[model samples]
Target: MTRISHITATAYSCPFDKQHQLAFGLGSNVKRDVVLVRVTSEEGLVGYGESHHGQHPTAMAEIIERGLAPLLIDCDPLDNEGIWERINRQQLVTHGLGAASMMALSGIDMALWDLKGKLLDQPIYRLLGGTRKKTRAYAGGLALGFLPPDTLQAEVADLLQQGYTAIKMRVGDTPARDAMRVGHIRQTFGDDLDIAVDAATRYSLGDIPEVIRYCEDNRVYWLEEPFTPDNLEAYAELRKRTAIPIAAGENHYGRYAFRSLFEARAISICQADLSKSGGFTELKKIADMASAFHIAMAPHTSHSVLSAAGNAHLLAAIPHGILFEADVAKVNPFRTELAQPPFGVVDGHIEPPHGPGLGIQIDETMLERYPAIAGPCYLPIERSAGPTG
Candidate 1:
């Protein structure tokens, strides 16, 4: 019958070469913790999945091992929908649907899909109705911040040389500095390259007009996350005021949150992360909804190889798929440690990965080498309360 026998999860923390600087967040030496879920069947075949553990590896692992594993064990792994439904019906856990619970579910759901693909002898994209087209990629996190203007120019040159037709730069250092950098990149790269800017939600509603105008004048393709996800009204205002499309939804999780964004007309480009948005189960729904609105999905990719692989397959499946975020950060685990570093960008396009399921193989040795180090890599400044009352 190929019943699900057991599910096991482990966490790993990998260090980055340097601090990853963003507008609202600062990550010192990319402390990436990945949760690897192993789903074993009665027939003895095993399928693997990875969840980007981010700041909560132990919590995520505990959820999978203690909370989810008990319910998942002895169930049929082939009945993905049934299993997913059972998990979703857990009132206690499903209420928030974020943080450790969702992360654990993401891992389990991926492993379930992986097992299904292995059982059916097909790749995940094929199972999702085959490829629509080659997944296109854009150079992401191209080292705009913490570098001199000349060094930034050199980095852009390297990205262009690496066959990237499009690239996104981190902004929000200072509006004037950002404008100068954008102008420099535009002038240097010319109008041939598609340049996008991400403020990482550091800007307020007042900052949007200037940023949008600057981006539009400089011929920037898109401006991402100008305001926080909670500021939908600001996003709506920004959308109304700007010619430059606003890209968001990476911070927003699930279809419910995205539907609100769509209803509000707050976002033009949807950048859902498979790892963060409840895995493929929910992300596919989100993609379909975005497609109905004629919105393009340029999925936000960072962290694990599973995310990259899963996103690549999803991109191949969705007709409205646009650009994939290729992390250009040197210390990114996606490039260094993750199982299948995505197909190298060739002429601005990424070829879909070919293998059963997500096509990612975990390096257990490497996984063990990087254990969880102390410190919250993404603690917000507002939450920096001390031990004293």
Candidate 2:
């Protein structure tokens, strides 16, 4: 019996320079942040998982070390559902920690699954009864933001050359400018290229009609998070106005919120982040639920290769899974240097890791180099544009 012996959530940050910084609907990204969750069992076997920093690495780390670790110590690492329920009942429900609790738990839960896989000497996908297979991927991450049309087109062309047939660009500038960016890509690349746009939960309901007009005219693939996660009505309303698929769920917390998305018939595509949406335990249920409603599954990739590998496994295991968001940010050490064989696109698709657990090896020494930087990863919306004067 492998019992959990110890758990730690260490925060890490990698700052971007002026050359690599990309500004989108949310703000300009200055740094990438992630909480690396490590779980060890009594026998000395170790497993790793990642939690999104939630723009506050220390805060998320504190939640894991101080808030969650006590509850999980001595629990069976193999019993993922049982352990998940224990935390769900104790912290998430009773204390009302909401998304913060869920996000922290996401990492812990992911590590436990990794532990379970290592215990049995199997990959996470095999543990979930999934076969090893490739899933379609798109060029995403912090690149392709609100750049000038020519600059954005050049970025798209580069991703195409890398073998990605599909790409997601950032939007949520003024409606006219946003349309110009979308239209430019479609006109430049023609219809063979698939273009999806993410507004980063930055748009209001009033901003939709015009955006929809351009997306429709340009044959855009989908319009993601045009409004915040809580705005179910806005999503449902937008669906009525446009044929372009509405994709969301990255910021949403658990299956319950996703269940609401189904009941409302709000989105045609679901993009849950495994690191933020309660990890594999909850996300598997969410994926099953999505299958019933006929919604496509495209889990959002986070700051590191851990989530990238885990999401690819989940997508491969599930029947309705459609696309994977490959983080093609120009500079992200967390995705490249921190892990080996860095996650990549092969002919526009990615496959689950074949090694035991989440599979890739990590260099703990890398953590020292990227000690957590204080403050948010994104600059404020106004400051992001810089020098409008």
Candidate 3:
């Protein structure tokens, strides 16, 4: 049996020149530091994972190196589920279930899966019962912030021209502003294109009526995160009042959290993040539950290549998988210099990469060039001072 010999973590910062914005937050031009994990077995097999250190790279790294690594040094590398359970059960040092812990576990779990795929000479999706279809994608977080009307129109046109059938725009800038943008996009795209809005937890119950009206009037596909994560009553209320389906779950942590959402009938679409929602293990359970409820899944992705690939595989396995989020922000390594030239985007829809594990071949040398930098590269506008204003 191959026992784990060492677990190593390093951090890298990749700059994004464009300032991306949501209703509640903003990201300035900077190279976000991403924490990478490498697990080496006594038999010399190596598996890699990524922790998307958006605003907490240092903290995530500290937890992985100082806290989680100690637990895995002499353990069996193949016992992924057992190891995850043990870490979850840790009374004092077992904080790897949520936030930094879940982030760290995501990397570790990915590495384990990678190792398993390599050992068996099969792709992770194949090991997970093969794919149902070539994964389809949608434009995600691409058209956000308050841009000039003409500029926003051009962006939507470009995405449509690129062959995207569906696109999500950031809402909650203000109901009036959001209405104007949504109306403009709907008018331009007509009823054929699928358009969705992300309120990003910026709305109150007071804002829901107008927002729901805007979505229905414009034939919007779904409305996401209209209320904060804890406000399930608000979600249920909003769902009852609106014909447009309510979508959420990106901010939610694990299956337990999702069970609450399902029980309340708070969501029609679930946007689970593979990296944050306890990796493949927890996400699989969440997807299964959504299937039972007949809820559609469109996973949230804006982290690293590993997350994108992992989501693609996971989405492939699910019956109700609809669209994958494609970060259309230019100048980010995700769109530019990361991995190989074609990061699997084809005619606006991304096809899953056909290789082992996550099927993402990261450029290690590029990672070395961009050592981990401190602070969040993308700070919310309020945190970014007056420039965003």
Identify the candidate with maximal TM-score: 2
Choose the strongest candidate by lDDT: 2
- Span of ten consecutive residues with least summed lDDT in model 3: 380-389
Q: Per-candidate RMSD vs. true structure? A: 4.6, 1.8, 3.1
Q: For model 2, name the residue pairs that clash.
A: none
Q: How many pairs of residues collide in each model?
A: 0, 0, 6
TM-score, ranked from best to worst: 2, 3, 1
Tens-place lDDT digits, model 3, residues 1-389: 77888888877776554454333324334555667778888878787776656476777777778878888888877677888777667722444345667677767777777777766677777777757356667887544556656667788888888888888887776777788888888887688889888887888998777887788999888998988999999999988898898899888877888999999999999998876676776778899999999999998885667777777778777778888888776545644556664475577766666777666676776666676677776555543212222
**Across residues 323-367, which tens digit of lDDT does each residue of candidate 2 receive?**
999999988888888777666678889999888888778778777
lDDT string, candidate 1, 261-325, tens digits: 99999989999887677677878889999988989999888566676677788888888888888
lDDT comparing candidate 2 with the true structure: 0.88
TM-score result, candidate 3: 0.91
The candidate 1 region of ten consecutive residues with least summed lDDT is 380-389
lDDT of each: 0.74, 0.88, 0.75
RMSD of 2: 1.8
lDDT of 2 at 31: 88
Give the poorly placed runs of model 1, Cα more than 4 Å off. Answer: 17-30, 91-97, 340-343, 379-389
Q: Each prediction's TM-score against the native?
A: 0.90, 0.97, 0.91
